[model samples]
Target: MNCRPRIRASLLASCLVLTVSSACGGGEAPHSAAVGGSPAAVVVAISDADRAAAKQTFETVCFTCHGVSGKGDGPGSAGLDPKPRDLSDKTWQASIGDEHLRNVITMGGAAVGKSPAMPPQPQLKGNPKQLEALIQHVRGLAR
Candidate 1:
């Protein structure tokens, strides 16, 4: 089935979120854009609330495949051909960039040429605070 319309809708929704966020007058630093119109990294501050939510999300969803200890050996991972990644693997963590992790989290593993079983989190795509919080949590998992 064709997916262009859905892709367009998602893009439009993302643009709308950026526009609304920019107009809110909060102290948030500019995201994905910088002075003189240059492309830049998003700089959202992850709050305590964000961390709580991230933890909940990780426990409820991520831990199903990635174990509670981030060891990639959750009960659900039994007999899987390509097993879940060990989140605490320092070598693997060091090999990937944050943007790659972000894409895999929000767009699914298949988007990054990994297993299709890893689902996409479209809900988190527009929530940088939570996204950053989750990313930080993953980073902290490194052993």
Candidate 2:
């Protein structure tokens, strides 16, 4: 009942980023990688409820490698070889499809032909919604 406004603001910002990520032609993931252009842009203005869920998931699950801004400079990136991809970089980020991102997260980087440093999240196997949220969070980082 007494949360800090700054924390709330940060969560909102993260939500906005994820919404834009999903809207930016990333498709619904799972073999869908096309950036659909302007129509997708409109969806970037997603509801706060969606952002809250995406932001919370990212903070707890991905902040280690992707960091708060998804810049791949988290505390866990020190000894990595290829280094974590900067999720916030639009160009490099664009090269990766939403499904590819999902694969990398759920099945790890090796599953999607990426680094071994990026471990797979088998625990999320049965949770389709959470996996989707993670993908959206990755997409949001691009924004």
Candidate 3:
């Protein structure tokens, strides 16, 4: 089936969120954005460029196990113990700090007392901004 309508609808929704954000006297998401149905859900108010980069990184690296929307049900996750993290989990996402997220992504799960199955993303390390973007992208998945 064609998905253009759904895609357009999602795009429109996102645009509306931006417009609402601007009208509220700032370009930031309110608290509701953290859980869903808003812009300020994960990470923080980020630039478009950063959002794009983070998304690309997630799609390229994290999607294999985290799945497209981070539900932890990617094709590869089926055979793994503990499975990949469901990045879309709002509570799980909120409880974790940005630093913790960076550590897990940069050094891998084993370094942070998590499952060893999660690989280290050395390429994402050392770059603070890029790391933050990925964290934000993960946060956005909660929505």
Candidate 4:
């Protein structure tokens, strides 16, 4: 009896589970609206725990392209056509706001007239609060 069929079936099941989980808000928070049905203003509150988690996530995922210090000299930067953003530079960050950064992280830089090398993080979904924390952490690096 071949185990290949069973293994393939298991993999397919896992993928389906992940897809459903993502759609149902397993990790990300659901969007909310105001009383008038208008889009509510998002107020981002960055906690210490959220900042720490964001920092860890950045080190694991973003450090490969953005560098540990965000100097755009990561190991993957050598092969990239357009290098990653340098977080250490306040001048570059001056033009972009926190909302822009969050959008880039969630939707990729190409979505906002930036480099395509920056891909969207679908696997690493986070709520608006978590995103705000991550943005705050990145802003700190610019200083």
Return the top candidate by TM-score: 1
* Ranking of predictions according to TM-score: 1, 4, 3, 2
Instruction: Give RMSD (Å) of candidate 1 vs. truth.
Output: 8.5
How would you order the candidates by lDDT, starting with the best? Answer: 1, 3, 4, 2
Clashing pairs in 4: none
For model 3, the stretches where C-alpha displacement exceeds 4 angstroms are 1-47
TM-scores of the candidates in the order shown: 0.72, 0.61, 0.65, 0.66
Q: Please, what are the lDDT tens digits per residue for candidate 4 over residues 1-143? A: 11122224233433444444442134444333232332322343346788899898788888999888888888899998877888889898887765567668888989878898998975434365566667777787886
- Whole-model lDDT values for every prediction: 0.73, 0.62, 0.68, 0.65
Candidate 3 lDDT over 100-139, as tens digits, reads: 7767898899998999999998886544457777887888
Q: Over the stretch 1-143, how does candidate 1's per-residue lDDT look in tens digits? A: 11112334244434445454552135443333332332224445456899999988888899999987799998888877699999999999998877777789998998889999888998988787788789888888899
Which 10 consecutive positions of candidate 4 have the poorest summed lDDT?
A: 1-10
Model 3: weakest 10-residue lDDT segment is: 1-10
> What TM-score does candidate 3 reach?
0.65
**Candidate 2 ranges with C-alpha deviation above 4 Å:** 1-51
Give a tens-digit lDDT track for model 2, residues 30-105.
2222343311111223455656776887887677887889998888888888988888999987676655665577
Off by over 4 Å in 4: 1-41, 123-126
